[model samples]
Target chain A: MQQKQVLLLTKSIKEKAIKEFYSKERPTTLCIADLGCSSAELNTLGVVAELIETIENARQDLGNGSQEYQVYLNDLPGNDFNTIFRSIASFEDSLKKQIGSNNFGHCFVNGVPGSFYGRLFPTNHLHFVHSSYSLMWLSQVPIGIEDNKENIYIASTSPPNVTEAYYDQFEKDFTMFLSCRSKEVVPGGIMVLTILGRTSTEKYSKESSYEWDLLATVLNDMVLEGFIEEEKLHTFNIPQYTPSAEEIRFIMEKEGSFILSQVDVSEISWEANEHYYKNDLPKTAFTHYDFVKCMRSVAEPLLVNHFGESIIEELFKRYLETVQVAMTKEKNVFINVTVSLTRKG
Target chain B: MQQKQVLLLTKSIKEKAIKEFYSKERPTTLCIADLGCSSAELNTLGVVAELIETIENARQDLGNGSQEYQVYLNDLPGNDFNTIFRSIASFEDSLKKQIGSNNFGHCFVNGVPGSFYGRLFPTNHLHFVHSSYSLMWLSQVPIGIEDNKENIYIASTSPPNVTEAYYDQFEKDFTMFLSCRSKEVVPGGIMVLTILGRTSTEKYSKESSYEWDLLATVLNDMVLEGFIEEEKLHTFNIPQYTPSAEEIRFIMEKEGSFILSQVDVSEISWEANEHYYKNDLPKTAFTHYDFVKCMRSVAEPLLVNHFGESIIEELFKRYLETVQVAMTKEKNVFINVTVSLTRKG
Candidate 1:
């Protein structure tokens, strides 16, 4: 899903956001910031290369020979900045080589350790901003959700207040994210945000409803086996949300800092089908294991922090078995939403 | 010398540089960058705290209650940033407590891993810049001085090219430093640089002459004792220089980006003299040991890299005995020069 979202950026967003910003501003130093830039350097550096290429093309069009880039890779303090910093010297070396050093735009990389919920950069300091698979993470789990028992996210079995509390937190967090970026980004700046979200047509929809059900079911299975405490399961809630496209549009309207230039919504299948495999492949395919790995990469840290590390292997084992049974009869896909915005003057 | 330079900042540099920048710009988020912010969290954070207080006090003087601080702590990419980053959370917590959090100026700290010899920030993005004991480090060892044999620096017994090579490197490095900073700092921005320098009156001064000679002396002693190679001792030259106040002033004039507003020169004792000794300490004093430890902190890594790790224990052991003998007959003090600069329009 993220790969497709990145592809969307290369086709549409690269042309609109960066090209427009460059033609309008012609800033000698084009400053870009990547919010929630994970420890994985490949994804973050790929986006940077794309943005730089867009700027390079724009400069070539205008007969501009000179420009520099200052990229701020931001994340929570615990993110592995050392790994990224270690990779930068070589990253810059290759970037210079790929686009001849003499003609290429000089690039500077920095790590800004903080949350994007509040202001990160100084006023009118940024030319472009981006976030990928990061905005779904709320500042925290929603308040007044104590009765959201035995479930880590909103579900069909959840009470009405549970959904309301989660949405309330999302509205506040997404609004704050927009308002903060408005101040940091220059007028006519651009921001491209890719969030996992449902289509606006799904009215009264609980996004990730069945996904949470399987996770909760796995925890209950463990509870029956005397592995995890029932009380712990009752109190735990994922500090995340999957909003509808309409909910995101509403936040932008309330914040009133950015014009929604474009939004694209598409569903991505969770399981890889047999179409890609060759005839010689193994027969007892663990198609469901792929889903477990994907979900575990996102949720393992939170679970380990909340429930302790001892239950992880058993928890995932039970989750894999449950997902295998569910995969045959049910459809599972993530709603990938990409939105591009222009900072209002 | 560095400790005194930091003290000078608390008394004079803070009031002149930060206060002037704050009063002139009235920026809501005052940006400050510390070039060569070493891994010592105490020293870097101390400077940051002083900068914030200066801005906080300036804001208070005008009855302004809202302000934010964004501090960029810069160092070479190889620096031990993990230790400093690990300490920031508690540091911020204490800072917020020290100044009441309700209306105190919010502070943001970021680590920029790079060399300061080139442009680090965006054009006109920095408000104030400062570096302590950092500018004395030349970008590299000057070329064509392989004949300055057996000695690590310019010495009385050395050829003329050795002195000329060291001075040439210092001038080029310093001028480049100024020009690069001029592009990044805003017009009327302030910079306070504390360099370990000579008093400028001496026509043939060899700053750190005896110090490096003593180190060379120790290395040669090891070489004679069959512990190190003679070829290695002759090939190594320190990638550092201590310029006189006059030389520094000349570079600023040549760079022509900053106006020299104030200059103060002071000498700091290299050894712990009688004045600092307590009543109950051991009588078998390692007074020369103080200088060895200080120099080791700065040069140990370079030594270990060039000569291998095996020689360090024995080399320093000989260095202490040589320094102890030299201390009885010589005067050793570091000449500290502090210059305040304002970026010219």
Candidate 2:
């Protein structure tokens, strides 16, 4: 998923971050941060590497490649930072190959272990901020949505009240996030966010519901088989939302800290990467295994904490088969919303 | 050990960092770092907690209390950052108790995973730096000391060339460390370093040799009993050194970036923390179990990496017994050397 998003960052880095140095005194160090940077081995640094590469290219064009970098990689405390830290030596070695050592000033990478919803840095510190597939997540599951029974997220089966609860929560949380970041970023610092959202013009996205509805179906099967308690299933909801472009724009205006510079809506195929699948199943038009693995990474910890560890294998297996059926019935794709913003003094 | 050194930090913080803000426009944030902050459960944050507490007190004295904090907790990548991050919420809670919520601004703690031997940050960024019981560790074991066979560290029986090699490595590494930090730390900013060292008038303290000799005796016994290889024991040297205050001063003077403000020598009894002993080994004169456990955490990773996995349980068990016998024969204590420095422009 992040692989596709990597290309989107180059434009932000080249235009907003790199080009600014041409007109001003080039700082000895460039500080940028990636919020909600979930670690998955080497793939976690892909965005950071792309950010540096773009800056280096632009630096060469401007005839100076001597600025240092202070890169902050942020996520929740439960993230696997060890894997990311262990691979950094190799990452630096590879980076030195692309930009020669004489031209490359030191790139000091640090991991910020915390939530992005709150104040993650001191005021007016960061030069640029980037969050990919992160901002749609609420600080916690929405209130008044406990009755969103049998469904974990906004779904066709969910009541209209449940949808309302989710929208209100998104509006409130996104506003808080903007308010916090407004203080952390310098007056002219820019931010580019790539969110897993509903990119359509409609208020309710039918295309996005298939993913969550399929997950609910898997849990329902386990409940019928006496593998899970009905009460536990009723209370479990993912602290996530997929917001529309208008919803985001509305919240930013109400927050009144940043000017929205760019808003892009795009569709990404479900079978984005064939190699991401683990099993050697015969390749099919619908990539159920790859999608299942992706969802498992996001959902496993929550499920194990609530439903116990006994049902994970069976749950994801059921989810894969259910998704297989749903994809066969209709074509589906993830909606990505990429927005760029400039801090307003 | 860090508990005792926490008092030494208040003076540095109050005089150097806090007093400066009185004359200048109060920046909304304060940037500081704790380098080589080895995680020991909740104890890891003791120094950091003290740093913030002192600053808050000084801020109140100056009649200003609103300042955000960016605290960088740095250590080698192998350090247990997970434990420290897990306990941060409680640390923050306790901090709130001390300072109260109205005056207690946000403190963003970040983990910097890398070696301090090279450049860790960009030029003139950090306002303050603190390292405790960390710089004594050389980046790697000195070359040419493989001939210092059967002994893990500086010992009476090692060849003179072996001692020279250790000294040379320390000088080179210490100078490199000072040079790199000179760039990272802002001019006129201060540093406080508390190191485990030999504080006696004699260059080589007889007090320190009991530790390595006991470990050497245990390994020799293992080799004789055919439980360990003789060749492997010869190559495994702990990449550690205990320098006198004179050696530290000489190197700092040669490095020429920091002005040494104070060098205080103190002695810590072997049984500094009785509860640190994991087992109930009845009351005794020496804290053998506590000392053994401390050595195990530091040596286990290096030992396991070189000597394989089979000997660890046996090695520590034999090590404890050896330390038990040595302690009864003589009383011993750890020498601490705490120094304060100001970065020069």
Candidate 3:
């Protein structure tokens, strides 16, 4: 899901960067940042490479031939920094090989460990900022939602108060994020965010809440089979929320630091991986095994922390069976929202 | 010694910065770096604070109301970084108190750990570079000089070949330093360096080599007293060199990256600290006690590494007696050199 969204985000950046390059006196040095850049080698490097290639192409088109670049990769202090440092050499080498050393601008890549809720870089230092599939995560789980029994996230079964709490938390986090970036980003700088959200303005839209509902059902089944205690489900709430387009615009305007240039909503099938199947079968054909593997890679660490290591294999096996039965009844789709913003002068 | 030199170096920077600010389009964000900033709290913070105050004053004089700053402190990886990190908060707080928070520009200070002989910053990112009491120390002891018996540094009794090797190493290290800075610094940037050097062109001038001779004499006395092995003296050589003014200019031009702007040399009496002694005093105001305390603070670690810890007190006591007799003959003075350069366009 994130891979597909990243492609769309980079495409949008490519389209607008040329105009941004020429709109102001061209900066001799370009400063770009990726906030919440985790230490996943392939995905992180792919995003960075695409960003650099697009910026370089735009600079060439505008006849700004000698621009240098400084790229800052930021994440929390507890992130897997050793892995990122070990992989930097190959990332730089591959970029140089693909772009040709002479044609590519000089790039200095560095890591910044901190939260994005406050200042990171010097004031007016950054020219472009990009975040994808990251802003959906709140700083922490919303207050007063711990009693949302048997629900891991903002599900359809959650009470009205729980829904209000999640909405309020999202608004505060989004406003602070914008306020911090506004000080670091130069006037007229561009920021693009691809967030997980809902197509409708309903408080508990099925399209955005159904996935967590399915996850809760699997845990409840484990409880009945005596695989886990029932109280554990009530204690764990995912630090995540999906908002509607209107909610995002309201907070952005109230923050009063950015001008909304564009907002795009796209629908992607939950079985998007089926399109890459090598066998001669229908495009919609995907097994429960594939879906379970994808979910495990994304959620394994969080799950392992809550549930001990001994129960992981058994828990996911049961989850696979539950997901298989759901696929037969109806096709599930995810709504992704991409917003483009310009720093206000 | 270094505190006095830093004041002079920062004054030179203040005078030229206003002209540089007006000569070209003013930069919205100013980047400054101090290469070889070791973990000494008072000296390091004093140097940084003065540099920031001077730059801020220059910007105001030019009527540039708002300019942000990014300061990079560079040193080797093995330096005592914990001390520097612990001191940064107080450093920033003191600066804010002196210059009101609203009047001061936003300054971001970060540490860059590496050798300055190689690239440590993004290309063309830096506006000004300052180094003091640091460039005199070479990267390592010059090749083939380890066999200069009973001498730990450049001295009057050292052979001609030893002198030639030191000069050759200085030239190579200085050239590489310029080459790396050339790429990192913006065109028209200014660099100020205060180097320890000689007043005369002779390779073994007494003005530069006599201090080391005195140190060597004290060490030889320790060996005879059975406190340390004689062979230990032969294996130790300090990684230091003092070049002539002609050598510095030659390297600046030969590297072809910077133009020499100004070179100033001054002399200070070795007993300059004695001026603080006021009121009535005994005829023999020099007891070896004060001299030993000063030398131990500066050279204790180097001596302890060569000789055992048990001999430190005895060695410095003997060193003080020898220095007191030398001072009686004539007041010893050291020759200091300060050079300014501008990056070529």
Candidate 4:
């Protein structure tokens, strides 16, 4: 769903940049990098396939159909690279069937395991970079937010200091990210990113923080029932933040390594895929099960680390009930921010 | 021993090229690739360390002391990368002790698991490439040598067709090698290789083929004693060759992608390190045990694939006896050839 939205938002810019790269750079072998390319949804390669198709189309249109591609799938060191490698043979075969074996043979894919915050490729080697649904994650939870014992993330009830900590951390991390990428990307290289952001400039907006508020309520109930320690809840904070457009632009401009080519903002309903909302059926179709499942996959590591593995199922069960009740009262939506930038010479 | 000799032969050339690279390219991040870098000796990183030291010294001399390095250690996919990664921490620490921590932090080392017969990196990314004592092994043994049953490699006793087949295979493999590296290395990049070669123009010279002749004698004895089948021996030629320097020059010029910078040939006595010759001791010191052990490490896989596991110990015992007797009769030496080339624009 995130990929579909991101692709929809950046379709024109992506196509334009690919054509420009073919006509201007004229690189016989184009190198591309996909950062934070996790294999959970099995759609990372789909993104690479789309990128390759675009380049192939542009190359053919420009009378350079023989250009080769070297695609790198990058993720953290602990990601499931084994599964990715195991699936590569079939993936290549399918691509060959789609693009014809002669053209498909020009593409080579390899896994690069590392953090995106550091330099992973040779300088000025990459021509195009794509990242989606990954930059919102801070390297770690904002420092000094421990005193916000009742909340797992920035919330309306929290003091101003909590929000300030998160904003400062994002500024530091995003600046470092742009700085590293500036060195890796070649002159006139293009980078497209889809990130979680808030439409409102206000830090305490309910649309962005309410999901965490409901999750906090679920964990509070668990603590009251003696399912987990209150201290563990107090010590744990989610290593995620949704930035505002102003915040993102501020960092990009401050870093001054790239020129923003385009920025688009769109909203996704929290209950966008609920059966009741999709089919216009009765309210009985409304359930938080899907939401709980999706959020659990993202947050399980932190939950398991803090509360142990035994209580995960029960915790999420309570989370589903809490979210189901809160969803009827508030129609929360998440802001999706897509930005395209051209690397400076 | 091979590593030491290769490094000694290329020391002056490597140093000179590094200095020229610093003055000409002035790359802030130097990329170096070491192909056929197996971890069997646990000293592949030592080679990288030596390369880094040379580059660092050159950079400092050119007033570019802050330049960083990225070293790629490449080998077949079946290599023991776990051992290499396990030893990397200590390797980095030792490097830090030698060069200050600030300088050590500038170097990054990674394992690239793949064959050198194809592309393993981005085009024009590498500045300096080194390979040693590995190019002699063809991807597979030459076809049609199956009919030549008396020897396991090119030998004077073998049919003329057998020598032709081996030579044809080397030409194919070496041509593909140069073609691939030409695309990967940047214009003016330097590649230094130390390959096993023969000094004589004759394809079946005793200097290169006598080792296999003695091994064949050992295997024949095993067949006579009913320890192994004679038919298995006939089909098991080693996938290796020692090309003449002229043959190498011919292929390089034919490929026409690189200019020959330097070529040197040297010979090492077969018994150079044997205790008998080192100390002028009695015949009791005439042990082929070291030779047997070294060859077994290299040939065990092929031998086990042909002969059953049960006969390995007995086969090597006979091999030791055969080598000891041959050493008394005929002194043998191996010819080592080192060549340096510059990639053309």
Candidate 5:
């Protein structure tokens, strides 16, 4: 439901933060890949824009005409690489000219298309890694939270406590993340990770998603108005794996290599476009309350049951109203994102 | 001039910071004092509050309340000791009622009045020491930086740089501070220092001071309008010592034996109280920018020689108007403060 907003927020963070890592006369070869990058047409420019700025700044720092970089764009198979490539081609010439053709060259571009959940690159190959708005979506919903009838995970509930099963899954995933990066990045490489986090452990269960407060309000409103049955609501949960700061710190301590350099958390409002729809009432209600599409995965069985035959039409219809509601509300939901850990030698 | 502002800022910081070193359960037959404690109204209470919180949280770790403390309250001769004595009287009854009377019965309190820079108490008599907001003022300004006629140090523009002389004097004073504490505080004791600092070395120059800016602007305006000499304006400088964060770190490192646990730098707003005169100005200008006073320390001598007393007053009247004009246009200033380090154990 917050796909567009999430993308925009991530992009802005990327653009703003890249400057800090780039300096003149010392153009750093930044090798960044967005993990779990989904197939969404929107917000692609934001990420590209951020990378362009970073590369250009690095070239400028290299001075006169002496800088070069090998750019690697990585994402899952579902992401629209064709569109990304086409977009990069359009700006490549001007960038080369501005950076001085002799001193700089086209971002020697290549795509590494695969799941970031496992190994994708050679050992000690990257100098910098950046990922945004993606970690919360677990590779799979935790098996412990799964229900037999629907074969779906119903997130957390009334009392705030992370189901031990969910926490165990997150710990495993985080360890996997460390191992993957530890293999790919050399010692002293820099990483910028902005992920969803929880302030309290107890709050995690009752409000299951990393952004439970925000999504819960939307769901409760839907139930009160009868758009989504409270029983059906029990079948869904935000696809999330949020760890508290303390838990994350504890994991880092156990991992014992990465040093935390900076931690920043802020509330951001995402932008979305609202539009007209034909079916009016049912479509509008569906658009406003269907958190399921964002929550669904290709592997999750609930997607098949919920969408059945007219999935595309229904998903499109519901998205418009959600945007309208979010716009009318004068603000959108928020997530707590923390950036921590510096690569260590 | 900034006494009240410093007082309030220091107070708020104290309430939030951990009081691990100061506690009632810390057995000390020796009487400890926070001379120039400003108001030791909190001398023992601060310790007791920390002890209670710590003991309650880790009763097993502490075992029992067998440790007793004797706290002394001391300040400059004219300080408000009645309040300190009264607060002690009230806390005594409360302490006995809260913790078993016998557990805290050994505690004693007394007040001493004198300059901390001199022999305020007998030598080798104290077990712990704590002082704040009193270190910056020298027992007397160095014999230099003063004009023979005025007797007040016109240190504003004495040296072009932040001045090795200023740093030399600070080192001497700080060493005195440590030596004084070392004498009274037993071999195995802890001392915590929280002081103001600047993140950059740029704020110490005459050209940077707002008063200088105003005086220059007024001089320029007067020059353009054919009222004052440009050559005369060149003599003015600002008197201020805002050491950079690195400089402070260096000073502590030089003093040696201090382990830094946490250093928190917060940009404080002088407008914490809106009704105060300074609050009427931008917190930055008032808190960080008082370049006029800084300018006075340097410019007055030059003005006295060039413009003479009567014309100088007239020019200052116009300059004051220009300052108000500048301040009304823009207000907050930024200062960096670090609270870090532990005395070498």
Candidate 6:
């Protein structure tokens, strides 16, 4: 289980949001949900534990020890939500015993396993929302990215300004995101989103980003050597988005239903090294590492197509060399920015 | 000054010997001479040129009409007096004309210059030896490479290795190339040596190859912030050795006695295209615009001092971006190699 290093920059902004929620928009039963939650024992338990601590701390500080809260754990159907629900169940049981079940109530956690872009919770049923390292992924690639495919999941570099198709999809996904939140989140609910982004003014070219370039290079090597046909290349897409800070701010402010409270930016060093690949992360973030590991599955098909049976051995060698070189040379850093906003009551 | 292409790759092994002599041996001559001869341009003029044309037209009948040959223009100094003077000169230059009041019948002519690393002429006083692009510079680098004023020329990757130092020095200078040839040639003889070399090689470091790193990143802004200093760089060696082919084989076969042979090597390309700039090459040797203009000069100084002026403005900007992203990129072919020889005897 890899434990993600909490982004201190985003954490600071989140702290302010939590404060506003507890002070101004207090509810008898606060409904908090972290969307795109993957089922890792620690993520389910750790975040719940943190939420409990925050609520308790606020209650004790304000001399109002009678605040009730309900936390929700949600993710896509493919995510490990079952484990999350079980972990949440155990957590609630443990806390009910220690803190008087009646005085300090436990959260009624649920895993709404579906794409968060569309309607998930009933209208105006949510209070606080938090999403970390997610939301940037478009629901599906915009149309026309591939020669004949129906939907595009990844984008490739083409002639100048030819990514209009991907941008359109991103626009749809963002609009859906805003509308989805607008329906479920209470008028005064606060939402905090921390995702990847870029600062350069250059338009989004597939090869413009290091992550995209590395992936494309690897894939192209496979395609050129006949490991995988060109058709297979179009099947996959990085569901991530790299909105400039300005772009994100514009989207939220223009939506008009949400009032921007704060925006914080920082870099996340995620290179597989002593710090990242030691396999010492908390159980909560292990799912993220597992997702990264799944990428090897994608590379495997390409390798097998090119090198035949020798693909496995050759892949390991290439992977080792790549990891070594990447660890030493210009290690990867995930640029992160968090925006916190309150819905208009 | 004719432009050199890929012709040197086809030169015969015999001619290779003489050119080495004219460039490295520094022999003296009493008759004809070749100055600063280059392998690539050997066939651009003289006998080789005729040989190429003959080969090209071999399908038709051989040309008729023959004339006696007197002199052969070989190299600047020590050259192959045996072959250049005895055979190629007569066989190739079949046309001749009478030209003296004294009625001296000058059979095939011979002269080689530059550095006569081998013997050039006979024991007694004799005729001419020519050299072009052979011997006008140091044969090797100075003894203080490790002790250069800035300590920039450390032999090998670490401490200096004298053997490697010699190889390095040989690659750097072209003037100090006459000692042995000077002793072999007789008095009252002509010696022409054409050499190529630099003023110094101690200024650049290995990091120069990673230029894109320094130019396209924050390094540029850092320079603007007054972080880097400025300095000068100079090269004093020519990694090539041109010893008029004749001089070498002559020294090997005939202990000491040999005569002058006409020597000739082109020198025009040295100063051509002194001011041209292009982002991409046009499939030609002259396409290495950056190498001749900016790269060679800046490579050393920018790398050696860690604070040279190369960090200013665009250089730093480009360097940084290149470092952060471009340095990791790979290319298939990265180096160019060219060397040729000619027999002058």
Model number with the top TM-score: 2
- Per-residue CA lDDT of model 5 for A1-345, tens digit only, reads 454554455554554445554442244344555555444543443454456656566556555344334445556544555445454444556565554546453343444455567666555556566666666567765664434122123244432233556667777777778777786776665566766555655534322342243444554555577655666555554455666667777776677767765665555433322232335454333233234344333323443454343343444354445455754545443455656455667
TM-score of each: 0.88, 0.92, 0.64, 0.77, 0.39, 0.43
Which prediction has the highest DockQ against the true structure?
2
Whose lDDT is greatest here?
A: 1
Off by over 4 Å in 3: A8-13, A18-25, A58-64, A81-89, A101-104, A214-235, A268-333, B1-30, B34-67, B73-173, B179-250, B253-345
* Pairwise lDDT winner, candidates 4 and 6: 4
Give the CA lDDT, 0 to 100, for residue B151 in model 1. Answer: 83
lDDT of 4 at B181: 92
In terms of lDDT, model 6 sits at: 0.46
Say which prediction, candidate 1 or candidate 4, comes out ahead on lDDT: 1
Please, what are the lDDT tens digits per residue for candidate 1 over residues A175-220? Answer: 9999989989999999988887776453235444667688999998
What is candidate 2's CA lDDT for residue B320?
85
Better of 1 and 4 by TM-score: 1
Q: What is the lDDT of residue B155 in candidate 1?
A: 68
Q: Write the per-residue lDDT of candidate 4 for residues B1-345, one digit (tens) a residue.
A: 345655666677767766676578877678888899887866577767777777766666665557677777777766765566566667867887776636443566666666788778777778989888889989898999977795899876788999999999999999999999998888989888888888999898888888788888888877788777889888889999899788999999999999888888888766654543445676546686666676788888888887868888888888888888888876678788878889998
Q: TM-score for the first chain of model 3?
A: 0.92
Off by over 4 Å in 2: A1-25, A276-287, B1-28, B276-287
lDDT of 1 by residue, B96-193 (tens): 77665478856778889888988778778788898888998999989988887788877677677887888898888898899989988889988988
Worst 10 residues of 6 chain A by lDDT: A148-157
lDDT of 4 by residue, A175-228 (tens): 989999998899999898888888888887777787788889888888889887
Residue pairs in candidate 1 whose N, alpha carbon or C atoms collide under 3 angstroms: none
Compared with the true structure, the alpha-carbon lDDT of candidate 3 equals 0.74
lDDT at B81 for candidate 3?
A: 47
Reference-based TM-score, model 6: 0.43
* Decreasing TM-score order of the candidates: 2, 1, 4, 3, 6, 5
Tens-place lDDT per residue, model 2, A1-345, is 534544454355435643563335356677889888877735557666777777777777778858788899888988878777887888888888876647688888998888887888888878778888888788888899878889888877688888888888888889888999998888877788877888666545776666777888889888999989999999999888898878888889889999987787777767664454545654455456776787788889989999989999989888888888777776688887778888887
- What tens digits encode model 6's per-residue C-alpha lDDT throughout B1-345? 212322332233223433343234332221232333433343323533332232223212233222112233434322222233233334434422212112222232222322334333223222223343334233444464443221233322324453355444443332122333343333433343333222223322232212322332333344346554212222322222223333333332343233334333322232233344343743232333333334334343434445444444545345434432432343211111112222224
Docking quality class, candidate 6? incorrect
Better of 5 and 6 by TM-score: 6
